[model samples]
Target: MSSRWLRPEVYPLFAATGVAVGICGFSLIRNITGNPEVRVTKENRAAGVLDNHAEGEKYKENFLRKYVRNKHPEIMPGINKFFTDPKY
Candidate 1:
C-alpha cells in the first residue's frame, strides 16, 4: 500500500497536484489578507507616525505606566520600590 504511493508514474501526478495546491493556498492567503503595496504618499505617512507618538506623549506618563497605575494599583508599591530603592 505504501509502495503504491511511490510508483514512478503516480509520483509526478501527486507532486504536480501538491505544487498546484500550495500555489493556490499561497495566493488565497495573500488575496485574503491584503495587497502588499503601501499606496499612501510618503510625506503624509511619515507625518502620521510622528503624530501618533506626539499624541501619546501628551499624557504625564507613557500609556503603560498609566495602565498599571489604574488597573493594578496593588503592584504600585513594588514598582515604586524597584525604581527608587538603591538595593538591587
Candidate 2:
C-alpha cells in the first residue's frame, strides 16, 4: 500500500527480498523436519538393504486403475500396456 513500494526502482529489491525470505523459510522448515542426510562411506556403501516386498506379497491394484482397466480398456492404449498384467 506504500507509495515507495509501488515505484519501479524498488520493484527488484522487493522481489529479491520476497524470494530470499521464501528460500530461508523453506530451508529452515526442511532442516527441522526433513529426513537425515546419508553419508556414503566405504563401510556403508554396500551395507544398505534393498527392500523387496514384491515377492512376498500380491500387488494390489487401486480402485481407479481397476475401474479404468475394466470399463475403459481401450482408453490410453500405450499406458494400458504397462497395466496389461492383472497383478500390476
Candidate 3:
C-alpha cells in the first residue's frame, strides 16, 4: 500500500502528534536528570549561610577571570594565578 503520510490531512495530524510526544519526552528527561535536590536544598533555610554567599561570589569572580584569561591570555597574565593562590 502507499504511505499513509502522503495524504495532506494525515500530515498535519502526524506532525502535531510528533510535536506533542517530543515535548512530553523532553519533560520526562528533564525531571529525571535536572537535579531537583539541589534546588530543594537551596530553598531550605538551614542550608543558607553567609560563608556560602561569599564563596558563591568568589566562585563567580574566579570563573570570570579564568574565562577572560582564556580569551586574552597575554593581557591577563596574572588573572587565573591569583585565584589559585591559597590566600583567598
Candidate 4:
C-alpha cells in the first residue's frame, strides 16, 4: 500500500474543500437553529419597546393638538391642511 495519504498536489485541494464544506455546514445549522440566547427575550423586549414608543407618540400628538387649540387656534387650519395635503 502507498504510504502517502494523498498525492502532494491533491492534498491541498482536499484540505481546502473540506474546510469549505465544514463552513457551509456550520452556517446552515446555525441559521436553522438561530441564536438561542435571544430567541424568547428578544421578541418580548422588542414588543415592549414598540408599545412604549407608540404610547409616547400618542401622548405627544395629544399634547400638540391641545397646545395648538389653546395657544394658536388659527394654526389648526394650517395643521389640518398640512396633514390632509396630497403630498402627505
Q: Could you estimate the TM-score for every candidate?
A: 0.35, 0.35, 0.37, 0.34
lDDT by residue (tens digit), candidate 3, 34-73: 4233334535546643345554555446545766764754
Q: Predicted candidate 3: what Cα RMSD to the true structure?
A: 14.4
Candidate 3: Cα lDDT at 45: 44
Clashes of 1: 0
Candidate order by TM-score, highest to lowest?
Answer: 3, 2, 1, 4
Q: CA lDDT of 25 in candidate 1?
A: 97
RMSD of each: 14.7, 13.0, 14.4, 19.8
lDDT of 4 by residue, 1-88 (tens): 4657656888889999999999999877754455322235555546543435564555456544866666644647778978888886
Candidate 1 achieves a global lDDT of: 0.63
Q: Least lDDT summed over 10 consecutive residues: which range in candidate 2?
A: 55-64
Predicted structure 4: lDDT = 0.63
Where model 4 places Cα greater than 4 Å from the true spot, the runs are 1-5, 35-88
Higher TM-score: candidate 2 or 4?
A: 2
Q: Compare the candidates by TM-score and give the number of the best one.
A: 3
Query: Which should have the higher TM-score, number 1 or number 3?
Result: 3
Model 3 scores worst on lDDT over the 10 consecutive residues at 33-42
